[model samples]
Target chain A: MDTYYKPEHLSHFASIAEGNKALAEKFFSYYGAVFADGALSVREKALIALAVAHTVQCPYCIDAYSQECLKNGSDLEQMTEALHVAVAIRGGASLVHGVQMLEHVKKSSM
Target chain B: MGDVPLLPTWGPDVAGPGLPAASPRAVRSLRSRGSELASAETQIETVSRVDLSAMPYAGSFERALRENGWARLEPAPIEIFQINLGKLCNMSCRHCHVDAGPDRSDEVMDPATVEACLAAIDRCGAHTVDLTGGAPELNPSFRTLVDALVSRGKHVIDRCNLTILLTASHRDLPEWFAKRGVELVCSLPHNRRRNTDIQRGDGTFEKSITALRLLNAAGYGKGDPGRRLTLVTNPAGAFLPANQAAMEREWKESLEREHGVTFDRLLALNNMPISRYLEWLEETGNLKRYMELLVTSFNAGTIAGLMCRNTISVSWDGRIFDCDFNQMLELPAVASDGSGFHVWDFDPAVLAARPVVVGRHCFGCTAGAGSSCGGAIES
Candidate 1:
């Protein structure tokens, strides 16, 4: 229960890779590029990031991307819809594994 | 029950002693009866009224505008001159930004101030004159102002709370407004009855539906260019309004199928956290969350189209403000040197050069799609 997972740790995350500057620099540069506006708008990217934040269940990402969604002109209704998309996919992933159960049950019962 | 009026009503008694009939410049403040008296100095009028000095929000709105390339926010040529007739209303709604009610009789604008407004309009040369109040139609000089503006070839907008038309005295308002080519921007909070009644009062939905039908019968909202009827909706609770286009579709379908009522367009507005609405947010323990929501949801694109840039807001007592929200907060329009100005001194050149007076409550206008007197800005 006692760990280094302080809420303030998120702010100090970049410090973790200070000992490995070259790799950390490359990773941050790539992240900055990935979220930039391109074919998909900044709004679209924010919504996508919100959905992924829900799927991964990162508290920091969820907090940051929720504000991101609103800052980019998305409403509560649109944000709720994006979260539901992540929920459906996560639920579907679990349900698809039931195919293995069905195949095993049918073969063994026979 | 059949013969009874839907709501108790009273016409404006302009000859009454409570409202001063002096010229606009002489009437500094229209002090409400049995309420706190305001001093002549406009700046210190309401010292404790919603101070923005220690706002809990983490960011500064001015810094945000600057970072977004707005070195100095300034006004463009004034196109709309909005006049707040007064705060007299039949119904005491729960979420009124004006805090308007039947008890606010003394706050009504006198005929002298109305005349001053017309003179200011001629001087400003603004294309549109927007008349709003607790219910602007309640003003005794409402028709006189409208007729004068129409004769002068100025576009007029009457911000009507639909139920006002169902009252006994205002029954002929629909036909009169339609005849003068006055665009009716009626307020109906929701399509369903529960939300509308909860935010307004019991039977408000029924009366509003009746008023909408009457407008429809008068050729308004029937796709006529001359007779335009637009519905304005604000969220019932502490949240930014849904998208205007999406809500418009839903409102059209539900109103048509259920009540057979129709309107030309739906304007969704975000409820500014001020007056009665701010009290509600504080009571529900949502004031902090709501402030955070507005600050975090700020959109830089809304700056260019902010209504304060294109509109001149004149208060009931002839004091000028940047917007109606500022009027309620007692934040008078200030020059760069920080002196206040009155409506009688309205100069287009001076108005265009003056910087807008803003405070933390401005977050209400910049949040999401952005809100203004004309509903959402971006959409």
Candidate 2:
């Protein structure tokens, strides 16, 4: 109760989700499929998951995916590059929206 | 084929000056049964005459490999040709297997041997050349070897101790290294100053930080294709490292915040209990426990990534070995003629076909996530 999140709480997530058993089963099955090795290796997927975790700012996912990336044999170089990918996208998304500001300035000047 | 200078035998006392010697009974037991002990222990007799009867395990490393379903531990095609340039290092760390120091100048590789090594590399067609030493840069012919390797488009790795880069004569090395596209793998035992200073020496962490800043200014570790910098870390204590990805994140954030230093990656390695580390373990009464820990934590998953499979190790005096650890212990690579092999007699096919020489110390490589020069084997 003193802390908002304990590391042990991560293991209990499945039980909590089980309250809605049918929905939980469906979600878990799909989740398993999403992470399986395909065109991208488990290592590559782990890196992607790590980037998305940072972009979304989820503490839980960040913790989970960090271990996953290492467990899949990805080194620090690969992980750092993946983090930069998220940073670039987030920064680029904001900067690209500046076209609206430019359009508004031209219209007002006219 | 000339008479090489005989290097000094680095005994336990030389490695750690104040450490007490093993008991008289232990020394006698090792000497009296040296042959049987050598066969059982899987390590060659200590060149310095330090009694190894104190080694906790009496079991054979070969037996463990066989019991685990391996016919024999064999080498794969050669890719990385690793050379131990010599034992002349500026800082003599307490746990160095090489027993390297500023006073180890006599052990350096001669130019003729260096040329033979280059010839071997050309013959083997190895894609990478990994150079190590007391401080490899201390070798007079080190730059010449690097230039030769780079000219041949070989990927050269300098296993550097960061503090060495701060030495007066070698100050401009960071720029020289970057221009050649050499992959710099610098050792930094920990991100924090306290642990690093304790393992290496006082003020070492500061010098390492300064050296890292110099490297950063030279465009190393800034996502440049040509300038790659890797930080190597080993635990300061008796345990295996925690997850590497988690540690890398911590290091990246701490270094950037505290020192504004950046590295391309971090490689967390395990401390193998050998030579100086073995002396420390014996003195601290952790020898038995550490051996037990290494043996018990052996993971089958790590075997596929064992560096000995793809790496060929050559010593300063032209002797070749299966790995650097074996090179330190003077265990030659398994040769068909049963004679010691050298860079001059280099043959990749022969090396790949021979079984790797395994000893009890090899348990260090298979424990937990496993360890190699490149870092962990099993993720």
DockQ of each candidate, alpha-carbon based? 0.04, 0.02
* lDDT for each residue of candidate 1 in B145-255, tens digit (9 for 90 to 100): 999999999999999999889889989988898899999999898887766776787788899999999999988998887799999988766778756776677678779
Per-residue CA lDDT of candidate 2, range B49-78, in tens?
A: 333343333345676778777779978788
Worst 10 contiguous positions by lDDT, candidate 2 chain B = B23-32
Residue pairs whose backbone atoms clash in candidate 1: none
Question: Which parts of model 1 have CA positions greater than 4 angstroms off?
Answer: A1-110, B1-57
Can you give the TM-score per candidate against the true fold? 0.70, 0.68
List, in the given order, the native-contact fraction of each candidate: 0.00, 0.00
Q: Give the TM-score of candidate 2.
A: 0.68
Looking at model 1 chain B, report the run of 10 residues with the lowest lDDT sum.
Answer: B21-30
